[model samples]
Target chain A: MMDTEHLGTHISKQFNADLENLREEVLAMGGIVEEQITLALDAFTNNDSDIADKVIANEKMVNAKEMKIDEACTKVLAKRQPAAGDLRLIVTILKTITDLERMGDEAEKVARMAKAIANKEMAVANVKLHYGALLHLGNHVKKMLHDALDAFARMDVESAVNVAKLDNQADEEYNAISRQLITYMMEEPRRISEVLDFMWSARALERIGDHANNICEYVVYLVQGEDVRHKSWDEMQRLAKDE
Target chain B: MMDTEHLGTHISKQFNADLENLREEVLAMGGIVEEQITLALDAFTNNDSDIADKVIANEKMVNAKEMKIDEACTKVLAKRQPAAGDLRLIVTILKTITDLERMGDEAEKVARMAKAIANKEMAVANVKLHYGALLHLGNHVKKMLHDALDAFARMDVESAVNVAKLDNQADEEYNAISRQLITYMMEEPRRISEVLDFMWSARALERIGDHANNICEYVVYLVQGEDVRHKSWDEMQRLAKDE
Candidate 1:
């Protein structure tokens, strides 16, 4: 009977080890998703189709990793029947994989935008005015994505709340960029379609920032067991401010 | 041993019953969300704060139902290791809950906008322009939501595809509304902020329409085992268009 008990303990330990490894893999995939966003933004800034193509090519990797992570989570849930922290970790992994996959899709959108603009001549030719704001906005979003992942991994609610704050800034920047592009189109209506595409790309990045903020909210839930979503922005800031 | 087997079967049946009930609740919630959108639009057109207040109050009900449905779904998933059709039903319930919740939020936004404009004097005072477009757009969205839910509940892939096509028309109408509102604001700079708020509300509704389309895509996946999400609108039309 003692030997049987020891064998059960050994199996539980091995299962936990595997679960931990799965968590690490999920985080690693998150890092790749973040990098893809950054590279996709770089492609947008530089008008580099090659880099954009690379980002598109890497989508399969992200999707595969997402599937594998999801399967691993299900396996852990089914076989181990993890309780409390382990269960929360597995659930978080499943949710984070979804966020990562969505981020990958956003990167692909940026890549498609890059490809669309790569061969087209500048309709207005004010390259700095157009690309500079986009690059700035893209960089801010990429940073937000990275910080959100870090916060999730560390269970750092403060960092997660900070990501929420950064999203407002990103929104402001996006609005400003939209205003600038609108002005450009109003000045030269012929550039309307191209500028509209660029606006969508910027909107995609802003949406990515929003999703990062969503992940941070999940982190807060994981840490504090509270739902901070759907609250007033001011209220969320106050609740998470001291964190 | 026979008694134990009977107990197991009873538990499973009870869980399945709970799941079916939860799906019905989600559909009911979806119905309320659709109603809220229509009522909010009616308030906007009729300039009726009473209607707007009703919509706002109804949102509380929507929120409460969302929570109940969510808890039921979690309970079902936790206690029952559902497979095949049962698993798909649970997943659809979960996804549909999110769509319903978001729809509720969008309706609330429209209600808020109606309240904001209730006291204010319209610069254009074009009731026809203001109420007519919103009502038409709201009707389109309501149909989309209804059809999407019907398709989901029935596991009807063809109806799901049809709902996707309707979503494009809604998008076009939404874009036209945006342009009209922006043009109005540009003509009357004093009403710029208020008109922009209205435009944002419209955009939120349009986003809700997009989510409905996404829900339809999931329904298609559930029924046909196909990922039709990333396909082009034109290609989807060609493949699944109803004559």
Candidate 2:
């Protein structure tokens, strides 16, 4: 939970409560999105159609939650007209939920891939062997998302920068996995479709890392009142380290 | 240009001017993004490295424009505290710019692919024969984006809905292209890497269609004050028709 005490101390207490509630709702949404990624990866790893089905079912709830939070942020903006940090808080929440919702969409993509792979008549051993790299990438992005939300909750710029940096690592992993999958496809052209599915799953996880990084960037924007989006690594580091 | 007449008419004339200025900025940004897609497709179709270079160079300007528009919108929200339709306009602009910036990124990606394919030793005839479906998909999405921006400029729900529905056609074209590319790759395993690049370019174009669709949805939200995001096609059509 955010420290509601410092948010809009000059404003009415009700406004503070509203901001607090908004933050919690975003975190709650983040939690569900995080779980979706986990279950999606698990479904792929274990070929669990039931788990994949659950993830697909959860997407509706995620979309509704995004709309709900977006409305709340708009209400706060319209009624409270919060300025400065308070204004940034509302804006950040609005942008953060969009990322969360997209992350959920990526998770759904992963689930669909998992379901497709599970229903195929391929051997489970081959599936696991081919997708081990995907699981590694999935865990990397899943952790990145979790830490990004944590950074947002505490308004921690250092933590945000740290998590944002992880996206580069996730990208490297994705590239390596893609190269390996390409090799597999080249070696066994008959399995090209299956290898491509894993490639897409890896792509989805990589995008999850991207969404998490975007959330971290939003945190920096919220705290510093600066738009660091599209900044180079060194420029972003300098801004984040300037405290 | 959006008619500045009705926006914030109840407020001070200055605030109305601010909203009008903001709308024009968004349209200007949309124009640049639209051109990026067009140039990227031409670069790929013609195997023209010079045009590809231009698209890559244009991305930075696109990013800067997005940040500029975002800052202006934030200022308006803080200074004007706009409500009702005015608030929705500001929020829609904020969200719309994010999609536009992403579209710029996708264009840059397409340009990079074109450069890669151009620098390769493959014959231009082979390239064209292999990528005909990709060019077809690219043209479909390009037209969809153009229509989507036109819809946004007019804020016409009918136009917006029509453009939003085009995304389904874009997806089908993308699917056909992907399957064709897969067949090409399977037929000539040695050309796997080159064909995969075309696949990625097609994927980028498909995503551009998605971003364009998102813009149309934002237009609907702006006009109708309804959240049509994540809604089914039928649901979105019903809401749009409800006027």
Candidate 3:
């Protein structure tokens, strides 16, 4: 197994604190991103423009937090000049926050889709917009993101790989929703615009799942010093579990 | 202006060469990604599965190149212990590859869409899946990506900002195409699937523009040491030229 304790055993206590602080900041940012996804989904399912607006408003804070974490990472790299695991930790944080920021952007897109759909009522009175699958998919990805963040906080490579493996499930769920939406459009062509908007929101949720998987991969890399991206899931699971 | 010469004046000749080699790798990777977009678009416009297969095959190489550049950056950081401009260079390259790799994925999506559309021909007789706007948008983003890489190569903040401004134009083009496609779908409901596929290709092209803009933003950060993300184009231009 990797020497996980070495991450916190630097001769410079301040450097250790810097790394710890960076981790905390990332978890905090992840919390905001997770909340954004939840709210964006609630807005879509419940047709609540107020919740969507809140998500949009919170996006700026998310962006600011990303910039803050990035600057902190640069400061740590320049000042401490850490090597080995510490260096990997910083690199992983840099990459993780980029994914987090993109997750926030995806959440914003979901919110925008919600707003657009709310502003324009569905053309057909009886043809209700089906969102059961989207809600299920949203919850699945949200749980995956939460678990991925937990793995990051604990530096657990096995759990990280497991979360990464959830991506296939998310893709399947997304494909099912796409097929269902395509059927709806065919049945009632007048609702095509709104149905397309729903597809975009579902697409956004699927992308959030992707970003969460990326974070899990980065976690595995940070802990094990192995790059698991673009690898088959079987290979990733084997590598993560080998040691 | 920031001291551009500092990037090349490192005392260790090997360190300088390593940084130079890293830049070359990134540009080479960018070239491959650019070609992927061009080929993917050709595949879509011409309904040629052969070119689509070529783009799909090229994606593996793109992924491999990203991993190689990432490893090189990590090595440079661990060994050279670069700071300031050199550190930013490595960070910028890391971020650039991520965007470039994503651009490659978007290209692959376009190729997949082309294959899907070609396999199951459009349901309508005379609907004619339009390509005029999509071709224009594809070329616009391609040039934007090219200019963004040129800005990175020269570390020119001004050029980066100018290229970043083109994102608005790309967005406008995408919006126009989306509207036109919606009209076609409404006119011929049977062709909705094919029109939607066309919409996806256009969306993919628009995303490529966004990634190119992201790369330009990273160039500004690398050269000027300013995090200009989430800022207005006016602010980015002012910041890029202020010195």
Q: Which residue runs does candidate 2 get wrong by more than 4 Å?
A: A1-11, B1-11, B123-127
Interface RMSD per candidate (angstroms): 5.4, 0.9, 1.1
lDDT of 2 by residue, B159-242 (tens): 888877889999998988888778767877777888888889999999999999999999988898888887878888898778
Candidate 3 local lDDT, B1-243, one digit each (tens): 232324565547788899999999999999999999999989978888899999999999999999999999988898777878899889889999999999999999999998887778655334343676788899999999999999999988888998878999999999998888877777777677777888999999999999999999998887778889888898998897695
Top candidate, metric TM-score = 2
lDDT values for all models: 0.76, 0.87, 0.88
DockQ, model 2, C-alpha based: 0.69
Binned by DockQ into CAPRI classes (incorrect, acceptable, medium, high), candidate 2 is medium
Go through the candidates in order and give each one's DockQ: 0.17, 0.69, 0.62
> What is candidate 3's CA lDDT for residue B57?
92
Q: Which parts of model 1 are misplaced by more than 4 Å?
A: A1-7, A49-85, A113-120, A125-127, A178-196, A233-243, B1-6, B47-64, B81-85, B109-122, B125-134, B168-203, B223-243
For residues A144-227, write the lDDT of model 3, one tens digit per residue.
999999999999988888887788999999998888888777777777878888899999999999999999999887877778
What is the Å distance of residue B55 in model 1 from its true position? 4.8
Deviating ranges (above 4 Å) for candidate 3: A1-11, A123-129, B1-11, B123-129
All candidates: TM-score? 0.79, 0.94, 0.93
At residue B224, give the lDDT of candidate 2: 86
lDDT score, candidate 2, position A31: 99
List clash counts for every candidate, in order: 0, 0, 0
A1-243 per-residue lDDT for model 1 (tens digits): 122213577888887797779868977998888889888988887788999999999998898887677657655665554555565566566666777787889889989988888868564366346788888888898889889989977888888888988999999999998777666656655555576668779888998898788788778867876656656577767777655
Q: Write the per-residue lDDT of candidate 1 for residues B102-195, one digit (tens) a residue.
A: 7888888888888778867655475346667877788888889999889878878778888888988999999999777756655555555566
